[model samples]
Target: MFLAMRAAVEETLAATLDRLGYPTDDLGIEQPPDDIDAVLASSAAFRLAGEAGAPPPKVAAEIADAFDAADCQYIDRVDTQGPYLNFWPSEQYFEHVLETGQDDDYGALPDRETSVVVEHTSANPTGPVHVGRARNPIIGDAVANLLDYAGYDVERHYYVNDAGRQIATFTWAYETFDESELPEPERESPEYEMVRYYRKANTYLEDEADEAEIEAAEAEIQSIMQGLEAGDEAAYERVSEVVDTVLDGMYATLKRLPATFDEFVKETRFMRDGSTDDVIERLKETEYAVYDEDAWQLDLPDIDKNLVFVRGDGTSLYTTRDLAHHEWKFDNFDEAVTVLGEDHELQARQLKSALEILGNDTDRLQTVHYSWVTLPEGGMSTREGTGVDLDDLLDEAIARAREEVEDRLDDRIRDDDLTEDDIDRIAHQVGIGAVRYDIVSKQPTKGITFEWERALDFEAQSAPYVQYVHARASGILAEATDGEGINADQAVTELDSRALDTPSERELLRQIARFPAVIETAADDLHPHAVATYTREFAEAFNAFYRECPVLDAPADKQGARLALVVAARQTIGNALDVLGIEAPDSM
Candidate 1:
């Protein structure tokens, strides 16, 4: 079934035909028509027959004879009808390839330390994470996993914005609440509860609020940020204390969902090390910086926006500090990408140009804007503390999913048997899988409105469906009395091509063959959903095949072949799911 390997086989065929004097260099290969008996059809010899003053039928027969004598074992029959050469997979090869992926790297690229540092899950340290930040790590982790599988040196990192004014509000609000009095259960999640603390602080400030206090508070926050950036030991210690309190709670939930980072780049460190200050002076020397209103701005005339670099008060703009950070990444790796929300479009461009202004290499710095559309909640704001906490959503998902699983199994077991901790882990897997699947399944540019049912459903094109399929395969493999686990012999077939004439079986073969190609395209485009979509399609095909062709009770040869097909399909779907940051559970 090398012909099922499609493109590569076509090129190989074209070269052979060309050497055999087919009077055509346009010899191409294609899959058979949707319902056709042949695996593929070629038109080159037929198309050039008239020019060569020969009958196309006779020319096609000659080409078919050449292929028949070749190394490929799949094509059993080659027939010419007018200007076409059609080849059908020999039954043996077709069934053999079904149980195994072809012998190629499956388009896996090599790692020469060609690294990508992905900065993701940079939720502002003001409150707990929510669906808004959910897609960030889902997408980031998926991309990271895909890059690693494709042989890239990928380091996942988080640029924690703990030094910003947002943290000041988080700290100021927590102090207002004296949250120490809260019950242990509530106190366990200081980050999530900080929203209430923020609300109390805002209510108190509302009575005495004015532009002066607002500006004064803004200045104090900026001062804190600068001190943290400037490596002021006292400021670092103070801010880290408050930030860590919330960060600890936040990290606990993030770890539960498994959003990890190789490094945590503190925004304060970017300033404290004088990197931003150094970048600004460098920009000034290159005339990229201009003094306006006693504030230095990075001139972006070509893009028609004068980006503020350093304020009139001599503090760095977000863009200036970001420039220093990117420079740091460029020094460390050959490439770096960012998984940011769509709101950062302008910021991305400004950051890149500012890097250019600072005389840093921007070409090797690859930036990916892994954007997600926010649901209609007026977006996350640190002051109001209104967006839903991701932990809450995860907690709810875990409870619901565990209930669903229990309902399906051990109907008589007491609820006590499912301990809170047991339900927590089960929920963590299904809940996070649901959240991750919902985002990864959608197109990156589509804006989403949060819907609970859509995130958790097993019948829909969601994580549950794919995970169930994997579990199904595991179930079948478990039932086997220690048959040789799927190995290279999936390439050996006991079934015939005529047996695969049915539409569903053909579709399964088509999808299995396209696995390598689909991944190659996805990796090149950095579109994780490509893999997501493929997983669904393959699963659908398998389901269809299952309904039509019973696997477990078939004849010995047929059952074994079907099991091989199951193994291939399961492995492929698992690989695709991994690239989308979804897990394949052994049991539903």
Candidate 2:
């Protein structure tokens, strides 16, 4: 509904500009300031004034005067504030929102023909997922959800880094360690066990292992890599088993966030299928390709760095394999999005450069490089065993959530209405939601210092707060119908827009109406924080309306209208939470 109004405003502005003989090609419309009580605002008059040699305020006034109310039925007034033209929505518009906002696809965009692939959480399979590295998957999943809500056909992908030296080191470690003496797999996940041995192996190679042992390990890893490249069945099977075991633990962790990948693309596939070789051959034909120190390199003077595509021993580098993978992505989808940590910024840029050199469209690939997630103590390192495992973090979150829920539901718990299972389920949802929301609610480029108190806060801008608001709205509606039911469509049909006269009521309606616009903006900007912010604001608006106005206790004529508003708030908030990949329980 908001998007429709925005479009109507844009169209009216464009028509007014055309009538005034001003160019409307580059005119942009945005929301007015919060204090302005306007739906849409535009400073296009400022630019147009410069183009037409007129004062900006005068031009803005002229544009406002030229706006035809009939052309934009939703916009009741257009006024000038300095050089800005702001538009206010009519009561008819609010009524339109209350009527249509309860639809299942209320905030969804029109389905598009474009296909997008979102590849993320491609962590090395040698270690368990750590809290420090959790940002990528959370952000990536939210991006995919946002795009899906925006009507893009999105595929969530996990690029398995199975061909790398990490895997080889893991394999060597597993072989060298006596399984009987290693940490019990039941105590920690298999991935955690593998991580311990892998770190042990690294320490041995660096500080304790003899030169011959080091050489022997290196030779064995090379042999494994060769077998992998050659598609030897036994080698492939062995590596697959190890990677699959680690992935089992990783997937278990991700399931807590309720995130799932549509596909898993192995890096080894590129090497085994000759795509890596094709990339190397194509690079050799490019002017950027050079041979230095017996290695194939791409000398990019523009970036003042040289990226090696192949080592001195004729083995392909990670970048070479990644180029092939990106090419494959482009060929299969209209657009590809890769989510990585800030540390991979250079590699991402280098990947684009390599794609450009290969004569592929670099614009097809979008890389979102997020900053690190750290503990309050400091940074984390997987190899040093200083990183907090994702499983452990989730367990802590759930434990905290259980305490909060139990405290809040003390009466119900004592009455035997809220079972232990119920508490557990709600705790899991709230806990995972808290962690995911905390990470994705921040801008991608900013680092987050995860805190249990902040993350699990039930009163702050966390998921639990929003979920509680949703539950509160549900409670109001449930009471209105005496726990029977109030059909949202039927309730809306009885709505009288005149009853929505209070400031808080109008503000709630406006916020509920903004859901579609927020989704669109988030998808376009690749920022899930927009949705997160909107959900909080919507909840605030609803709470204000609830406090200032009576729903069931209102007069007969106003009761239906307020009930409709409550239903709208509930549906819109639920939808917003869904887009953020957070569940909105009807009862908290």
Candidate 3:
């Protein structure tokens, strides 16, 4: 309803401006500020005041005077406040909002014909994921969820860096290092267990290995890289076994956070299938290609630095292989989104420039660059073994969440005879939700200092708070209908907007009405934090309504209306949480 109303207001504004001989380039339709007593506002009057040779207040009044709200079903009236043109929603609009908000699929947009592929979390397969790099998968998953909710055909991908030097180093460590050499005790998971070998090997090379021994290790790693690139069956099989084992453990960790990939693409595939060579050959023919210093390079006009595609030894760089992968993505999907860390900003720009020089459409690709998630103590380094592993963080979060859940549900556990498994399940949900929310609720460009208190806080703008609101709404509906055979759906049919007469009721209704608009905007802008912000506000609005207005205790005629409101609020909150890839529990 908010989107529809905004559209009507924009259309009316455009027509009015054109009639008044003013420019309509900027519609300036936006939600009014908190102090404004309007549903929507347009600042186009201010934008056009310069051209009209008049003050903004006069221009706004002129536009408001000439505005036509007769044909708009959702707009109540248009008025001018200083330099702003504010719109109010009609009673019919309120009724339509509540009526439509009751649908199970209230927040999803209509399906689009476009297909999108989201590639993210392509961490090196050398060790376990740490909390510092946890933002990648969390943001990637939520953005994919937002795109899916916005009706795009979305596919999630994890690009395995199997052809890189890091994989060779890990494979060498796997074959060379002894279990006793591990710094810590062996872990049950392969990612955790094998990382010990890699760390020990790195430490030995860094702190104890002689020059001759270091040279031998380097030679072996080069041999492994060449063998993998040349498709040697023995080397390929050995590396594949280790990579798969590590990825298995990594996937287990991701599953706990509920992030999954539709595909795992190996970088070696491009090397073996002649795709990388094809890319090099194509670049060699381009006007920008430069063969200098025994290396193949592209001196792009717009890029400050030259991109080297081939080294002196004739081995292709990761950037060259990435070109092949992006080409394949362009060939397969209508659009593509790649999530990268802030360090990759230049590479992302270079990739687009290279693609454009190759005559492929670079406009179809989007890149989201996010800052790192550092610990409160400091940043993390996997090679140095001085970071908090994601598995351990998750374990700690689950333990803490269990303590919190026990505090809230102790009486219910005793009275309702809840099983241990039930508590475990709820704790897992809350813990994972808290972790995912902590990473995704901030703007991607800003770094986050992950703190346990902020992530798991029950009273603040955390996932637990939103989840609790959902559970509370569910409880209200359940109690009102317990043994009465009056479900929320039945209350929906008799819902009347006029019955909800209080200011708090109207405010909550307006907030609920904004869900669809929020989804559309967030998806278009690739900002999942916007969804998080809207969900928190929605939760607060519902709480306000709960306090100021009673559902079960209302007058008989208004009781059903308020219950219908609860039903809509519950579904809206659930939908918002789902977009953030967080679970909505029915019970606290």
Top lDDT prediction, candidate number: 3
Least accurate 10 contiguous residues by lDDT in model 3: 482-491
lDDT, candidate 1, equals 0.68
- Candidate 3 lDDT, tens digit per residue, 491-544? 678678889888889888998899999999999999999999998898888889
**What is the full ranking by TM-score, best candidate first?**
2, 3, 1
Q: Which lDDT tens digits does candidate 2 get at residues 1-588?
A: 898888888888888899999998966698788888787889898788877788999999998898987889798988999999988898889988988887777899999889999999998887778888899899999999999999999999999988888887787777787766555542466677667677878887899889999998899988887788777877787788778888888887787787899998999999888999989998988888899999999986567778999888778888889999998998899999999998898888787887887889887778888998888877777777777888888888889998988888767544665667778888888988899889989999998999888888887889898888888888787777763334434575875677899999989998988899999888998999999999888878887997899876777668788888888888899888998888887666
TM-score of each: 0.80, 0.96, 0.96
* Higher-scoring candidate on lDDT, 1 or 2: 2
Q: How many angstroms is residue 512 displaced in model 3 relative to the true structure, after the best TM-score fit? A: 1.0
Per-candidate Cα lDDT values, in order, are 0.68, 0.85, 0.88
**Runs with alpha carbons beyond 4 Å of true place in candidate 2:** 51-54, 185-188, 410-417, 483-489
Pitting candidate 2 against candidate 3, the one with the higher lDDT is: 3
Candidate order by decreasing lDDT = 3, 2, 1
Residue 376, candidate 2: Cα error in Å is 1.3
Please state the error at residue 19 of candidate 2 in Å. 1.5
